[model samples]
Target: MALPSVGTRVTYPAGDLIARARVLHVEPVATDDGERLAVLLDTTSIHPVDAGWPDQPADAGVITVIDGAALTVLDAIVAATDGETLHLGRDIPVRKGTEGWAFVVAHLVDAGSAIAEGDEVETRADALLRASLSRGHTACHLASLALNRALADRWTKDPRRDPLGSPDFDAAAIASSRIEPNGSVDRYRLNKSLRRAGFDATVFTGEYGADELRAAEASIDDTLATWIAGGGDIRIERDGDLLTDRRQWAADLEGGTARLFCGGTHATSLADLGDVRVRLELVDDDGTPTLVMTTRAHAPS
Candidate 1:
C-alpha cells in the first residue's frame, strides 16, 4: 500500500470514542524484542499520544474486523511521514505540519494480527478510561487558570496574560505536566530565571510559610467551586478535523468565556468536574526549589 499523501482525519477532538474506518496502510515496526505491526486508518476516533509534548497519554482501545475478529491495540502514537519514509513518535526529524509531510495516528497491534490493508474495522476506546482522562485534563486546565489568578500579584512587571486575564504563571514556570486517571501532576521551577522575571521565589521558604501556601490553595479551591457551581458549557473548537490542525478548549465560566490551545480531550461541562481540589507543595530539587501542584477531580456520585 502507498503512504497517504494527506494527514489522517481524527474525530477524538469531538469526544468520539468509537469509529468505523477503512485500513489505509500497514507496516512492520522493529522493536527491541521483535517487530510490531502499525495500522493506519483513513479516519480514527482513538486519541494518539503526542510525541512533542506528551502530557496526556494515549487512549486504550481495540480494533475489530468485519469478520468479528477483535485485535487489541497495544498502543497508539503520532506518526509522521514524508513521501520517502515513515517516522514513528520521537523518531521524526522534522516538526509537525512540515511541507511535504503527513501526520497520522498509528495504532500498534501484535505482529501476528490478521488485520491488513483495505480491511474494514471498528475502533473503540475504553469508555471508562476515556471519561476519567477527560475529567483529569479539564481539571488540569482549570487549576492552572486558578493558580495564575492566585499568584497574579507576585509579578512586578506585566507578563503574558492567560485566558482569564491574569499573569500566566503556569505558562512561564511550568517544567512538566502529566495527566493521570482522574488527576494531574504539574511541576514548576522556581530557579534564578523565574526570580529575574519578577517572581518572588523567596516567598516559598522565606516570607511566605506553610500558612501562606495553604491560603493560596484555598483560594484556588474556592475559584474552582464557583466555576463548577455555575455549570458552564464546555466545547472544543477546531480549525479542521485533521490530526495536525489547531484546536482550542473553550469554557463558559462565571466571569466570561476562556479558551486555551490544547490537544487533549475534556469533559462537556464544568458540572462534570465535581469537587475539584488542588494540593501545593514546595520542594528542593538538588539546589533549586520546585513547586508541585497535584489536582484531583471527584466525579459526582
Candidate 2:
C-alpha cells in the first residue's frame, strides 16, 4: 500500500477529543504479541505517545467506521516513514522533520480488524481520561518551575534560566518525567556533572539534608498554591497543525508569562489545575543519589 507523503494533521494540541477523518493507509506490523494493524488517518484527535519523549502515554479511544462498527485502538504511537517502510515508536531512526520523511500517528488495532484504507471513520478520545492527563501534564510543568525557584539559591554559578527566570535546574538535571492521571513523577540525577555545573547537591545529604529537603518541598507547595489560586490562562501554541510542527506550552503567572517547548496536551488554564502539591524524596540510584519529585493535581469539583 502507498504511504502518505505528508505529515498527519493533528488536533489534540487544541484539546480536541473527537474528529471525523478518512483512513489513509493500513499496514500489518509485527509486535511482541504477534501481528497488529497500524491504521493511519488523514487527521486524528488521538494524542499518540511520542517515541522521542514518552513522558505522557497515548490517549485511550476507539474508531467508528461508517458501517456502524467500532474498533478499539489498542495503542497509539508516533510513526514515521519515507514512503518505503513504516517505523513505529522507538524504532524510528531519524529525528522528526528529517528531509523527505513523513511523521504520522499510527493507531494500533487488532490484526484481523476490518478497518481499511479510504474508509470514513469517527475518532473519539476518552474525554475523562484526556482531561485527567491534561491536568497532570499541566501540574507537571508548574511543579518543575516551582522546583527550579525553590532550588535557585543552590546554584553557585550562573546557569541557564527557565521561563520564570530561575536557574534551570529541572532542565539541567531531569532524567525522566512520567505523567499519570492527576499526577506526575520526575526523576533528576545529582551526579558529578551537576556538581561540576555548580549545583550544590550536598543540601540533599548528611544530617541537615532531610531538613533542607523538607524546606524545599514546603517552598514548592507554597508557590504552586499561589499560582493555582491566581487562575492564570494557559494555552498551547503551535506553528502548524501537522504532527511534526513546533509547539509550546505557555502560561501567564504572577511573576510573568512563561513558555517552553512542549508537545503534550495540558489543561486550559491554571484554575483547571485546582490544588497542586508536590512531594520530594532522595533515593539511591546505583550508588548515585537521585531526586524524585512527585506532583499531584486535585481538580476542583
Q: Pick the candidate with the highest lDDT.
A: 2
Worst 10 residues of 2 by lDDT: 204-213
Q: What TM-score would each prediction reach against the true structure? A: 0.97, 0.98
Residue-level error in angstroms, candidate 2, position 204? 0.6
Off by over 4 Å in 1: 32-34
Residue range 82-133, candidate 1, lDDT tens digits: 8567799999899888899999999999999999999999999999999999
Instruction: List model 2 lDDT by residue over 1-301, tens digit each.
Output: 5999998999999999999999999999997877999999999999999979999999999999988689999999999999999999999999998999999999999999998899999999999999999999999999999999999999889999999999999999999999999999999999999999999999997679989989999999999999988999999999999999999999999989999999999999999988899999999999889999999999999
Give one clash count per candidate, in the order shown: 0, 0
Q: Cα-based RMSD of the predictions, in order? A: 1.2, 0.8
- How far residue 162's Cα lies from its native spot in candidate 1, in Å, is 0.4
